[model samples]
Target chain A: MTSLPATTERRLGLVIDLDTCVGCHACAVNCKEWNSGAQDSPLSDVDAYGADPSGAWLNRIHTFEVTPEGAPAQIVHFPKSCLHCDDAPCVTVCPTGASHKRSEDGIVLVTEDMCIGCGLCAWACPYGAREMDPVENVMKKCTLCVDRIYSETLAEEDRIPACVRTCPSSARHFGDFNDPTSNVSVLVAARGGIDLMPEMGTKPVNKYLPPRPKTNAATRTDPARPAAACQPDTPRPEGFLGWLDAALDRLG
Target chain B: MHPAISVIFFTVASGAGFGLIFLLGLGFPVGGGAGRAFAVSLAGGGLAVAGLIASTFHLGHPERAWRALSQWRSSWLSREGIAAIATLGLFGIYALVWMWSGSRLQILGLLVSLGAAATVFTTAMIYAQLRTVPQWKTRLTPAVYLSFALASGWLLASALGNHAAPGPWGIALVILAWAMKWAWWVRAGRTRLADSGSSPETATGLGFIGKVRLLERPHSGENYLTREMVHVIGRKHARKLRGLALALGAVLPVAILIITALTNAPAPVNLLAALSMLAGLLAERWLFFAEAEHAVSLYYGNR
Candidate 1:
């Protein structure tokens, strides 16, 4: 049924560190690469070399300007995917009973055969976690790598989700949130990880550790210049105007 | 909130169709005496089926649409499908019985009427339940839907049933429907992410620091999220469209109906009113989709 499970034996999800994600799309790419062949290859890309290409992707990264109070703004690389909320609106809104949450692990998955591709589930999701594949005509979303996480054939190191395994900076951590001693739960407690939209009442399983504060601006002292590059110079005759005049005279 | 033509036609056409059915199922006198009973039933039933069919056009797998009926336990969309089918089925029996016997079944007619109303309510809930759209997630959404359905239902029945002008009650319904729509638009203007205690800050969980803004989006090219959710109509164009919709859908039809009611104008004037109203309502439905700013668009900094 599309109805969500009231409780699961384990809440398995990811903890993303906004402090370290570097805007690298390797997670997104490895995710596409592995999951493309995971479940009948629902994720699709259109017109790779063509002029206008549009398709579905399960994961993507965004960069944001986070300005701390009374401090300079910082750029944070944000990697976004399905948070697999305890109150998953996308699952309940599915008309076909194709979208459902597992009672065992609380991992949300779609039954591809039962999907009608109406796209209502996508609309219900506030996180843009679900994507409707233009080619296969099915709603594609993060399965939390349900196949890989419990696979027996793969090596022990390969048991984790492809995205978590491949992140260079270890920005993404996967573990069971139901266990207090798990790495994800420990990190959440240690770094004060937070939910994306708590006001939505979705009760997202995944949490994000905010970027650490950098109080002062960078002051690079290059040997050639031997000056603090962070200092702002006053606009006088000896400043930008003088340089502009010299450059204009050289052009003339 | 891209206003796909297929879904727009589905909602508008089906709303009007079910509205007409609502009137007929109330034991109206039209289907009793004359041979126009089949025509009336066809008008209502045919449009409902047509709209339902049109809805499938925008679906990725129209062939799999039959499976949508399975999840009525939780989904409003499924409930709508079930209600629509049940109403039409009961209506089929009721219309056929009346056509053969020429005597109205009051009890069955009442059932059909209730079914029609319930079906329309479910349709409204499909949009109203979306918290992802704060503009639509309100009581006003369903209220406007019911009012418009009632108004359009009366107009269609007036024009198509007896070729006569609708009475004072119908005219009042027209006024009420447009008034409700006007109120909805006013409220919609004030509905923002902040109203739901959601903003760029809450969306990022970075509000305690300061205001958060999107520096770079996830994709340089258009993805499904950007294409489907970020449809934005300019404020000036939206204002113009609203005016055009009100004038045509509301003012013209109400004016024509009133003039015909007072004077012995030609019966075809009702037809003109119906056409004008349909065109106007189409524009209104288009605006309904075009103006909806999805919450996901906040992540992309589009809204």
Candidate 2:
């Protein structure tokens, strides 16, 4: 049997790598799939695949076009969800002790039995991480797939959350964040990471990797295919809209 | 800060309730010829009680309302509840003094009524003190609630004025209340979004020294926003509603009351403005909740 401490660790967390992330949303999809099938409570969809399609998703990705003060524009895709903070405002504000942070593992979880569905937690959280499952009438979020992570039936490599395991680029990592030597800790140290909205002081455990810097030299030429070796499928337009002319020539 | 209907009814009912008592304690004569100032005070007092009962719906455990008074040290809800009870007690004493002493007790009743009104001001302060919620954090919150109460109270007085005796006091208080409402709207408009980085870097307590991007969410199920922020509303709609509230709550009522007070317009006009003020206050309360962003929304990168 998995020890209770290991089953629920105080240092539970995730480490995302921005450099390798393709923003394919596999993590979000797999997470939806696994959570909807969980025993504790399954996320539901009301009028799903219809006009009023709505369902629970612990994680969501947002795309932003960042034009740094003096730099050229760059596309930054962000996948947002809960940070399971040490001082979760959602937990503290809950009138009933429904919302709580695990002492053994830093995971913030809610007990369905105690939740009154008042939604005070939703207002207290700054990250917009907490969501109410209408069907169950309780709050739900990323559990780090607690049921599967330490299951003996699962293979050691597959013991991680469905989101981490399904990631094609190995961009997602999970471990004991308290240990300085853990893989996530090493990755965070080597490639600096940042937390969202530090001023609120929720003290979230998850770390986000910063987007890689794109230099002028890197953008001036195509690294994947040499410019000289590239064959034009179509004649190029000169000056304005040259790319559009080249594409037309290729089509012709 | 979604406005719960229970609270809306509570504030409005209690506000009008206290305002009526404040006016009657001064022994202002009504020209309406009903000659029942004492009865009007009792009715208004009853409304205040009704409003308090409605407010209980906002609590998780209505049965434990007594326990709420224990935490006045830190909880505004507790403070508001205590003030509410005190206001009721003062109103009760004012009524007893009025029945027994008549003009001789008027001074004492006026003092108690003012104290009761002060309690109502403290009740408004309860929601205004939550610095974490920027929308309620404004100094205008107390002024807005108090003015709203006075405006509603004055309007109620005017309705009963015709039955007892007509006077400029009702119309004057109505005009003053509307002025305060307009000032609150102007100040509320000036507040700007102060915090950003609903991103992980800011929310997770990580340093600001480096760039931060979300790679994977900690979980996969929908949690709170899908339920709360899901109340869809656009900036255009919010702006339009604000204009409507200001016109109805402030400009219209003020205009009507001034016309009646100055030109001696028919009783119907004053009566119309009083009813309009009640409806306008409700809309204003709704906007207060809808426009105000909760601190929790910061996590969703909404900032």
Q: Please name the candidate that would achieve the greatest DockQ relative to the true structure.
A: 1
Proportion of native contacts in model 1? 0.86
lDDT for model 2: 0.65
Q: Compute the DockQ of candidate 2.
A: 0.12
The CA lDDT of each predicted structure is 0.87, 0.65
The docking category that best describes candidate 1 is medium
**Candidate 2 lDDT by residue in tens digits, B226-259:** 3355233533367667677767766777777767
- Give me the runs in candidate 2 sitting further than 4 Å from their true place: A1-11, A69-72, A102-104, A144-162, A215-223, A227-252, B1-11, B14-133, B154-180, B194-247, B251-274, B293-303
Question: Candidate 2: lDDT of A186?
Answer: 91
Per-residue lDDT over A24-120 for candidate 2, one digit per residue giving the tens place of the 0 to 100 score = 8898898889889874778866666555556767877655444545555555556666777766766655545556677787777777666656565
Backbone clashes in candidate 2 total 47
Best by TM-score: 1
Chain B TM-scores per candidate, in order, are 0.95, 0.80
Q: What share of the true interface contacts does each candidate keep?
A: 0.86, 0.19
Docking class of 2: incorrect
